[model samples]
Target chain A: MDIKNMQEAELKAAIKKVMQDNFGLSDIADDADFIKDLKIDSITRMELLLKLEDEFGVRVEDNDAQNMLSVDATAQLLKKIAG
Target chain B: MASKIVVTGLGWSTPFGCDLDQAFDALFNGKTATFRTQNINLDGLYCQVSAQIPRNEAIFPFEKWQKELPGNKASMFTIFGLEAAERALLDAKLIDQEGGYVDQNLKIGVVVGSGIGGLEDHFNTSQVILEKGANRVSAFYVPAALINLLPGHIAIRHKIKGPNQSQVAACSTGAIAIADGARMIVEGRCDIMVVGAGEASIGRLGIAGFCALRALASGYNDNPQQASRPFDKKRSGFVMGEGAGILILESEESAKRRGAKIYCEYLGAGLSNDAYHMTSPCADGAGAIAAISDALYWSKKTPNQVQYINAHATSTGLGDAAEMSAIKFIFGDCIEKNSFAVSSIKGAIGHMLGAAGSVEAVATILSLHKQKLLPTINLEEPDEFAYHNDKLINLVPNNGIEASLDCVMSTSFGFGGHNVALVFGRY
Candidate 1:
């Protein structure tokens, strides 16, 4: 929950909201994995990344991209960058 | 001896999205890109909802969509094919704006197919003539939508000077292109082949034409989202889809020399015709069985080895059952009758017509990569008309199984009983 930590829960909530609003992914629970559990697939994940880049103001590299697979991971990264 | 054909790159444009990676990504995630469009601004015609590819005027120059002026739907396929080819080549490490991948000695080919072609555009042009006048009909109708030109334009633009061709087998158009391209590579005609299918037939004329033939789901119009339910009891005809799917096919030697990224292996292809009726398959599944048998034969593998099969189950009354019976006959009682990793993307994407087969091919590749398989979305109530053999355990929807599936085969049959199958195996 620390503002300095990038992988915070709030950033994850914001991303899940974006996915739900744009791509209609309502079934994605917090514990859901991006590729298997949340089922965001690869393309939408890219789309989601594009949205995140705009929202959180971060330029995620391909190496960093795959690591931000889960909402929690993305949140943690986002908070670290934004803070 | 036939040479080995490997897939180095694949590019697809769908109602889901225009980019190749984007479509492949979405297919794995189980997403539906369907939506309603009432484009009253452009002449006020009631445009029925469709999985429409948003025309990026920059990529698809409006002028290019037309030979002379005012583009039509047929040009949509041609335009999309060109863009996809570029992307595929880029993916294949062949040629890109970055200019690094093409091997000078590599003989390249292009195969783009369409199920319905520019029927809606051609049909709309006819309507415009009746409503307004003959002169109002742009002089560009014939040049735009003819099915043959889908590949012609792509070849002309990219200067793809090798075995230039196209396929048209109704919904199986796109898959046939891949199969055909694989054949070209195996036969040593080309080192690299660009293959995919495209369609832009979602206009009123296209849907109305299918409606006239009673081949579309009319009852589910109220709920468009649920309209394309495949393999369920409440199932009706397929929902018409329009778009293109392209793949970069190359020989393994050529790909390795160039250091290209390979997605998977195109093991083999099978193609056949029902020779029965225009649109209907042999009700007993004879034609489908023949096509599948040929595919397996070409693949040089027994049915038991293929862990998963992406079926051409369009959720049609006779087509789905025919395919099931065919699968039963080929796989025998033990496998076909059991609950396997059998499924269809049409249930989610509707009938993509020509684009159906190629995108589904992508799904199969992803299946091999991730080791997961999704069930047919609307397959809740199991109807065993053609699957009379107890060996067939119908896979239910919403539940995908994760397994170490190695070889997966995909089937696509078009109207006029044109049948094609592509076999894929793990690398």
Candidate 2:
């Protein structure tokens, strides 16, 4: 739960696990765009946001959710939230 | 002259597996797929048995379609529908080996239906709203639960541009889907139509609801294989099963032009409503008789010419007898002389709800093609109605029989007394 204290590799792994388990995506690159590369449409994007909220126990605002589109961006947002 | 309709391909995702030959062989061998329900808690439910597709079966080619369409948004019925539709199109040779359309300009449409379209998904979403909150519900719930989305997804995947529709006649949905597809071609709406039904309602609520109606077999929970004994003396009620069946129906000229392998000709389809009861058939079987008679009349064939019948005998006390009464009324001398065989594949695969008629349609078409009769398993002792004047009707009990089958009819009746009879003949 301590995203601020978590290592970069651990945060990235957590994000990847959620994407793989929920979206059936595996080996997603950290910089791969969710919409462009993963083809995560609007519905799937909303689902990913809810899943992340449930996983991290944080309230993701609309603007924050938009920025948390990739593994790297999501990790950055989670660290900022934990702070 | 009306356009001649023909079935060029058939596919099904059945409890016996998806391969057409393998599933048909299992049915012919009288193999039962009903088993004790493994996924749901049966402590409070009256029925404990269901026939579900094996968990390991790769029902959806996830990797193949994920690029074009995300698999996470689809419901179980859509998943089965897509798999069956893909197999059917491939079988029709309309799709090349790489899953691309062979003739991209062909006018194709889709009509796929389901009895309880995504009840499992709706149930899950309801729980999510109750436990987590309404805001937690997934945005994909609506599309996933709509019945029309089955055909919608099919059309999107195949790029079919003609009329796209879905029928929701409960148990008769499958037969009516095929019938409507043929009508579309006959009316020059489309040259080809993908027609069929799918169902996946074996969830907790599905079982409890059917149990409340006492419409499911409960006595044979310990012996699941014998639970669905259609026309048998010990039959209690129907067993719930989940799967999908699809067929490629094309205009005769279109099929010949494409040089496709024709399975059978769609002779006629008769639709009628009992207007009798909510969940029960009329004791006189008038509605069923009308449907069968209409089908025969339109096909220009007499009862004597129909060598086999795939009945909608769901193993209920009143349903089986009602069907027999109707058959006697329509096929009068044929039943007494044992000239035609009647069998219900529900004995082997249980009742597939909306998918039953189309699955049985596939079986009937195959029977005409192979000149073989499928068997009704678990019919250890025939019910009294299966006989008249000490001569028993050929129920094709326990084992498959070889026969010269040219014309065959498949009948389906739903809870609302909707009846549809489809007649097919060898091409």
Candidate 3:
């Protein structure tokens, strides 16, 4: 699904589902840091970047991928990319 | 005082299916799970037949796990181990989503072994290093390839805090994991131990390595179903299988206090080394005999009391016959009287390598639980060479055998002449 056109709520839901299903995680907060809160390592971070790119139908630059560390940041980036 | 150990839960992922009843039924009915696979790059390889675990939506449901794991962050080995361990914990009634009765204060241990760990990740990482540079390699490559990390991941996933370790003894890894995990419980090191093995080495490197050793069954590539014929006159070699098996073991006192449904007692395990060849077993079967004898001795059970054996017959010409010689030497008249029933599940699922022992141990424990013996399919005519005493016992050939099983033995021998035998008794 092209997640680029998704609204803020839809984007957040999509991100939440990815975190839960991919990482065997639950109870994720919008402010939760992927590294600090989710305990996702660098490998998982790379995986998250690729998944978000595929979901939004937008290519994530390496620099921007590093900046998008939390759910809110990721959704914001997705909105900017979609626009 | 040492505590008594018992298996309260069992879980496994195999080619046939994960449901114990359905998987065991298929195995007993001579159903073959082997198939032709082009997944592994076998351009120059001789054997193309393998018992690869198909993406079963009902059992593993990777599509669900994939939403979160879109990239190659998680290895196939890790998935198998996690899935099996989760089911085992649920089966033991130790944990649920809301967190069941597993005490957070208690020290829980995990021993998930593997014969070959994360070969696909290793292969990809090496190519990256060669083309780009060492600095360009993925950070997860090292942790994913290390065998010990299997248990590390499990312990972290389950929040298990205690003696977390893994045993990598090639094919004997699964049996050794159970043996060592039980020892930890008996020695009062942990209240509960999650023990088993996982193998997902069906990659290009894995297939090439084994094929170079001439260790695979190549003739039946066109007929994948008949590729792994253990103890048969036409037996050649084992077909590579990928999966995992996990068993939840707890102290007898802990199990009783928690009112957990017990499966079988983890009597004891015997380990020995041939100190001979690296790949071939000794013709005399000296290591195997000692391992079985030591298992019986440690379990304090006589030869007459054990009525069934989950043989390590890996469908090899020498390996099959050597194991039978050892059995006959130990169980003697039991074989003649048909009192001892022997079977190998390798014929159905092929050789799972590291997961073979633990998976077959599950099969053995299921036999004890259901009071039945599973069949060793594809054994049309027993190889005359496999018989040492000139006596043939009920091999449970090609069909399931319904019999009362009180105690059972499961054996696993690896490439390094590593021999491990485990005995389980009715709880």
Best by TM-score: 2
Tell me the interface RMSD of model 3, in angstroms.
5.2
What lDDT tens digits, residue by residue, belong to model 2 across residues B1-427?
3468899989888887778898899999889899998867768887899887867636334455454445348778877777788889999998865345546688788999999899988888999999999988887888888999999988777777788999999899999999999888988878899999999899898888899999999699899999999999999999999889999999999999999999999999988999999999998899999999899988989989998899999999999999999997778788777688899999888888998988889888988888889999999999988886677899998999899878999999999999999999989
User: What value does the lDDT take at residue A73 in candidate 2?
Assistant: 92
Q: With candidate 2 superimposed using the best TM-score fit, by how many Å does residue B331's alpha carbon deviate from the native?
A: 0.5
| Model 1: DockQ vs. true structure | 0.01
Off by over 4 Å in 2: B58-71
How displaced is residue A44 in candidate 2, in Å? 0.8
Please list the C-alpha lDDT of all candidates, in the order they appear. 0.71, 0.87, 0.84
- TM-scores of chain A across candidates: 0.77, 0.92, 0.87
Against the hidden true structure, what lDDT does model 2 obtain?
0.87
Rank by DockQ, descending? 2, 3, 1
Best candidate, lDDT-wise? 2
The superposed Cα distance between candidate 3 and the true structure at residue B368, in angstroms, equals 0.9
* Candidate 3 DockQ, CA atoms: 0.19
Model 3 docking category? incorrect
Runs of candidate 3 exceeding 4 Å displacement: A1-43, A46-83, B67-70, B98-101, B131-133
